[model samples]
Target: MFSERRERLRERCSGAGVDAALVSAPANVRWLTGVPGAEALLLERDRALIAVAHPARDRDEAIEELVVPPGQDPAVAVATAAHAELLGVEEHDLTVARHRAVTDAAHCRLRDLHHAVEQLRVVKDDQELACLRIAAEIADQALGELLESILVGRSERHLAMELERRMVDHGADGPAFPVRVGAGDHSGRARHLPGDRRVEEGDFLTVSLGACYRGYRSSATRTFVVGLAPQDWQVELHGIVFAAQRAARETLAVGTSLDDCARAAGRVLEARGYPPELDEGVGHGVGLDVEEEPRPGALEPWPGEFGKLENRVPVTVGLGVALPGRGGVRIEDTLVVRPSEDGGPELLTITTKELLAL
Candidate 1:
């Protein structure tokens, strides 16, 4: 599985006129070599070598021991062994002290391979998609269990902690991001930190979370009324946010631009007379990192601005409505962009979108 990825990276190196490239980014190294330790890959024209603190091993075999002098840098040893003319390293991932040592050992010009591997990872292949799907399933299961339990009077921090524990119990390596549990007036704040605020009967409860499975992550969010009956405004706000989220999800496709998706949700919110006050991006790419590439919306635009969506790129569509003192609602899901002919977008997070009274 990883051999193909390494070959593709090698081809990229050759095309970029780099005689040899070193991958040190943990995610990039895992993607290439399937080794889940502190490791680096040295890619040359005709061969590739992986250097690790521990000995290397075949992807399908047990690790083999190697002899190395104490206190020697694995990267320097790999560079020397490969006999590279020009050593390309990920400047962003490598530390200044490490970079200096690598340059001193190589005795060759060091080039920055900035985000080259990340750019390659933006598009998901079959195996990556499968991992993400499992991640979503784990998150959904955890959330489902949370809803089944009595939520009244529990502190937001406690709930968040419980969700994380449940995700870990359900085969997740860990929580993808901080579990967000906003109660009462705290609901709908983007990236809201969970506090000690206790859940109240009349408050609106919003929870946003995800699970990491096999290094891939998926996210989902839902809002519910904490009491026996919701106020009319709560219902109205939830309905509006739900419609906006649905519109955004429906508009996601391979050819759709990031701006278009944001606009689609924005138009719904605007039409409902509750446009977002703080203009955070509506959604973003998800993979190895909780948030990655292809950020959506005019808000928080990247250096090149929101780019076009590509097929097989997984992203989250999150729409939030924060109504000051009255709290708010947020609904989100992770989806894979696909061609319209192939059934539009593939929704990975399948938790129910309906607002429920907890």
Candidate 2:
């Protein structure tokens, strides 16, 4: 599987007029070699070599590797052994100092690879999708268990920690990202850090989290009321966001631009008297990293601002609206884009979007 990814990357490099390629981004290296600890990959026309700090911890026998001496840069070590006249490097992954060191180490001109591997990663294989499915399942299991427990009087920080622990308990490597728990006024804010604020009756409680399973990641967010029932206003707000999020999710077809998705969601919110800026963007790609490629933000007029959705590419459709001084609602889910004949978009995060009353 990893070898096939390398062949595709080499094809990308050859198409770009490079004799060899050096992949330094940890995620890209992992994608190419299937070893999370691999730091760099040197890809030549007929050979591939991985560089690592501790080769013994996690080794792939199928690929050759070199253990760099302590305090030495792996990219520089890999570049020093290159056998090509021109090397393509991930410009976004290398720092100026590291790039200069690599330049000095290799007697070859460097060309910017420029997210070539990421573009390759946008469409996932069956194995990759399997890992992502497990990740989403773990996150959903953890969140569901949390909902069944008593949440009143719990601090946001406490809830966040508990969620992370739960994901691990449910067979995840770890939380995909820091678990975000927001209560009352903090609810529905994007990336809201957990705080000392405790949950109260009738308060809105928003929990956003994901799980990392076999290097793949998933994201989901759900909001609930602390009391036995939701207020009329709370119900109304949740309904609006739910409709908006569904609108965005329904737009996840092959060739649908991110802006179109965001606009679809925005229109639903605007029709209900919400601001067009209720959400910065509709969603983003989700894979090895919690958030990866094809990110779409706001309704920018620029053509092809974030590119179009592709089949087999997993993404998150998250939307939220936070009313200042009052609690709000946010709902998000990780889904894989599939053609309608293939069952349309596959929703990985199975947690119910209903505005639950705890």
Task: Report the number of the highest-TM-score candidate.
Answer: 2
Model 1 lDDT on a 0 to 1 scale: 0.82
lDDT of 2: 0.90
Runs in model 1 lying further than 4 Å from the true structure: 51-82, 276-278, 297-306
Question: Which lDDT tens digits does candidate 1 get at residues 198-278?
Answer: 999989999999999988989889898887889999989999989988888898887787567778888888888875443
> Cα RMSD (Å) per model?
3.1, 2.2
What is the Å distance of residue 21 in model 2 from its true position?
1.0
Tell me how far the alpha carbon of residue 55 in candidate 1 is from the true structure, in angstroms, after superposition.
4.2
Poorest 10 consecutive residues of model 1 by lDDT?
58-67
Task: Write candidate 2's Cα lDDT for 234-324 as tens digits.
Answer: 9999999999999999988988966788899999989999996944687888899887887874432234445778889999989899999
How many residue pairs clash in all the candidates, one count each?
A: 0, 0
TM-score of each: 0.89, 0.95
Q: Rate the local accuracy (lDDT) of all candidates.
A: 0.82, 0.90
Return the clash pairs for model 2, or none: none
